[model samples]
Target: MGSLLSVFSGLFGSKERRILILGLDGAGKTTILYRLQVSEVVTTIP
Candidate 1:
């Protein structure tokens, strides 16, 4: 229905945001991404 379409649009109408993460090798970039994907707390050292 039109109302259902409007509600779905309202829920999903937000603009997309892009993020760029840059770091050198062994800088825990992958570790940080993994933690973010899993919603975990990560303790990392350089």
Candidate 2:
């Protein structure tokens, strides 16, 4: 399935774009992902 960001981007423009999230462990990658999917902040464990 496409990511939430991709879905939104498709609605705004024609050219497809991609994203890369780079961070060390426990840098809140999963937390950010959940926020993008749900549009809210959620508790996450590292």
By lDDT, the best candidate is 2
Model 2 ranges off by over 4 Å: 1-11
Q: What does the lDDT read for residue 44 in candidate 2? A: 70
**Candidate 2's residue-wise lDDT over 1-46, tens digit each?**
5698888877897776687999999888888888988999899765
What do the candidate models score in CA lDDT, each in turn? 0.82, 0.84
Q: Mind giving the per-residue lDDT tens digits that candidate 1 earns over 9-30?
A: 9878987856799999887887
Q: Give the range of the ten consecutive residues with the poorest summed lDDT in model 2.
A: 9-18
In order, what is each prediction's RMSD in angstroms? 5.7, 9.6
Model 2 whole-model lDDT (C-alpha atoms): 0.84
Q: After superposition, which runs of candidate 1 have C-alpha atoms over 4 Å from their true positions? A: 1-14, 41-46
Give the candidate number with the greatest TM-score: 2
Q: Clashes in model 2: which pairs?
A: none
